[model samples]
Target: MASTHILSAYDEELKYLNRRISEMGGLAEQMCGDAVRALVNSDTALAQKIISDDVILDHAEREIQDKAIVTIAKRQPMAADLREIIGTLRIAADLERVGDLGKNTAKRVIAVQGTGVPRKLARGLEHLSELALVQLKDVLDVFASRSAEKAEIIRARDEEIDAMYTSLFRELLTYMMEDPRNITSCTHLLFCAKNIERIGDHATNIAETIYYIKTGAQLEGERPKDDTANTVGAPAE
Candidate 1:
């Protein structure tokens, strides 16, 4: 009877950990969406809100870490169960990073405020962010479902996000070169684009974590990445 009771308590703790991860994931996704919306609309208030909310993500990560450690010490989970706890830790870390990247993007909105970037460039960023946000949401779903197949599919699709970033990189460069006045705004947008791309990379990392938890094996053969642009120039005034 004692053994059965201990097993039930362990299961309950795992459930609590899963809920925490889901909460963090939801906040990160919302922050990413809000960051892009703030950028497109030049909504400084919204951007500030996103930045402030990053602290919540930070606290969530710390909470998950504390809980995971305690659960390990108390439950002494092994094999797949241990992997689940470890995977939750890894996912929380990635989600926190996603929050940071989104915060960075939101800050750029303030930096380039009143610069009035071209609509086409803003649309380009919106498109890129759209893809990244979808990837993040889907990968979180994969984690919750614990489907290695879905996780692998999301991992394979990260190259598309990278390709979008590369294209935006070129477009922003052209905008700056064509009009020196566009340099400041385009440069800010460039950094924001890179942040969104990085968020996609984090989503891919989460997918790999899910894959590992499910299969106890990392996806081999070089996780796909497509950004190859290497030009860095001073921010235009």
Candidate 2:
């Protein structure tokens, strides 16, 4: 058991950690949204904005990391609290990758712009992006509250995104075959779908990471069906 002062002092620290993570999550969500918009609106400025936001994500990760280390040294959290501090380091790494993916997607948008691409794939990209955002949003809720149920819901959403990605890919492949004119646009769309898929996966990983923080065990191989949630794919690992 930790001393009263250790836990009490850290109550504020934990809250701040959650707050910082939430802010980082917001950055990730915004990047995804902007990446989609840049593609759909053909706005190079928005794409450039997405590229610039990566610095925020990087800084957030470092800030949270330093705080976590300090908390560990000062508080000496054991059991669940220790897991949480460590797991946050892992989760931040995943979130950083997600931010990078958003940047990559934005770069793809810039490349395809004015290439005479129809941008028709923007519709599918929008759907996939929304799915990812919702999952990540749920993860944020779960992390702040340490609610296993909320984390479970996020896990389920990942599968649905996977299914959508598969379907979107098939549709894109068909389009590319139907018209060489669509090759450029569809390929870019494929990239966007891939990015969304990766985002959904990161969200799911966050959920699992939170679950471990709460329960002290990894929830990887066991995926339960949620009739209430639309999880048709492999429920993001």
Q: Across residues 1-237, which tens digit of lDDT does each residue of candidate 1 receive?
A: 999999999999999989988899889989998998899898999999999999999999999999999999988888999999999999999999999998999999877788865788888888988999999999988887999999999999989988989889999999899989889888889899999999889999999899999999998879887867554354656
- Mind giving the per-residue lDDT tens digits that candidate 2 earns over 1-237? 566765677998988887888888888888988888888777889989999999899998998899999998887878888898888888888888889988988888766776644445567778888888888887887888898777877887677888778777877788889988778877887787788888988988899888898888877666533222233243566
The total of clashing pairs for model 2 equals: 1
In candidate 1, position 13 carries an lDDT of: 96
Please report how far candidate 1 places residue 53 from its true position, in Å: 0.3
| TM-score for each candidate, following the candidate numbering | 0.95, 0.87
Q: Which ten residues in a row have the lowest lDDT in candidate 2?
A: 224-233
* lDDT at position 1, candidate 2: 56
lDDT of 1: 0.90
Query: Residue 155, candidate 1: how far off, in angstroms?
Result: 0.4
Return the clash pairs for model 1, or none.
none
